[model samples]
Target: MEKSGENYKVISCGDVASLGRVVLHDALALTGAEVSINELPAGVSVPFVHAHKNNEEVYVVLSGKGFLFIDGEEFAIQEGDAFRIDPKGERCMKADDTSAIRFICVQAKANSLEGFTQSDGVLSETKPSWL
Candidate 1:
């Protein structure tokens, strides 16, 4: 599907992987807010402990068991579990050993890499920084 103002595309899990498709990517609002729907395969991790200078994000678990590591703290998450992180905090997540973790990640205000950098002085998103 297409939308006005900015680019809007329907990406599946299959697009991100192979089996499932229609997942959303790079859907950043004019306000710099970004939204994405991700469908993780049976075993996948959400990536590394990256921090955003001015973007607070929330993760809502949709299916399967979930595991999240925020600033070195580990957590056991399940269906209906929601994890929220503030800007400048190091965070990352992973899927359970037996099942995949499907979740929607939402970022408000500082969605763009530029905006995030402007919010704080950071060279890269992968590096550790404080807000």
Candidate 2:
């Protein structure tokens, strides 16, 4: 499901409770980032190891167990784990034999964040409806 207005958009990914990938770039008309929800079944690895030319990626593990391989090193990941990889780092992921793994990956240009949150937000006089 999706809804949009002049400056905002809301989308529902439906049920992400199974093994699959959901890429949100085109769905949301994103201009600056690529985001995807990925799920891997037990004992399965991503089809290929990859590195981005200009974008760094952050992954947040939402459920299950997995191993993240980055530049020849392996790190165990599970629910609530989050990590970032540099643009050129080789990376791949595999779900453990006993559990499927689901994660969200957010990719954006390397070194592109100029300001965030406190430094970028302004106090607006308009109040939220809940207030």
Candidate 3:
């Protein structure tokens, strides 16, 4: 839970496997949406390349270098960059050279542990096996 008198949650960042030190600034509860700030090191990649059935997302780079893959199309991204992905828009990202990449991630709605899935390069909604 977040502390009072604050609208942000500062998530401690560090080496997450291949991903380097990164902070997850979660603002989902505050904004009533899935909005977050992430500080990623270079040579790191996000967890998956999937989409949300009932949520939309966006990423804005604060620093470092990387590429944004949206629907299989790659685009060069750098500091002070922004991109938005609609609901169920396939997406993923990878940092280059352990470059410090700070970006904002927003989700329209929170999924109950069962995030969307990708099958045969296609995204679809499914129940989480753990549920």
Candidate 4:
């Protein structure tokens, strides 16, 4: 949903950072998946390792650096890095005292894909099909 002249909702990263251990969800309306902005202060991590029973999550790092521990493996992640984990995997994140971390986490049920076809490849009704 647009607000006034804007085409989409916007949330300030600076505004969110002030609140520690915060994850902002449903900031924008959507049909297929849920989204959240996750922030962690230095030396703190999401308190528990989580494994979702019905949804898979993709984490996109927006800033800072951290270790993403999934099961028993640790992967270093920094800005612009993105990773997806299955519903059965145990995962969590941690940021050291050196810097804070912010990221976008999007979740949806596994194997669910939503799409629409405006045109079909070989049909006249599909004119301008490649648009």
Computed on alpha carbons, the lDDT of every model, listed in order, comes to 0.68, 0.93, 0.66, 0.79
Q: What residue runs in model 3 are displaced by over 4 Å at the alpha carbon?
A: 1-28, 109-131
- State the lDDT of candidate 3 residue by residue for 3-54, as single tens digits: 4445445443344434443334342234445555575666777878898787
Q: After TM-score superposition, what is the CA distance of residue 126 in candidate 2 from its true location, in Å?
A: 2.0
lDDT of 4: 0.79
- For each candidate in turn, give its C-alpha RMSD to the true structure in angstroms: 12.5, 1.2, 13.9, 5.8
Better of 1 and 2 by lDDT: 2
Candidate 2 lDDT over 18-49, as tens digits, reads 62888999889999999999899899999899
- Number of the candidate with higher TM-score, 1 or 4: 4
RMSD of 1: 12.5
User: Model 2 TM-score?
Assistant: 0.94
lDDT of 2 at 11: 96
For model 1, the local distance difference test gives 0.68
lDDT of 4 at 40: 87
* Distance from true location, Cα of 99 in model 4, Å: 1.0
Task: Indicate the TM-score of model 4.
Answer: 0.72
Q: What is the lDDT of residue 66 in candidate 3?
A: 85
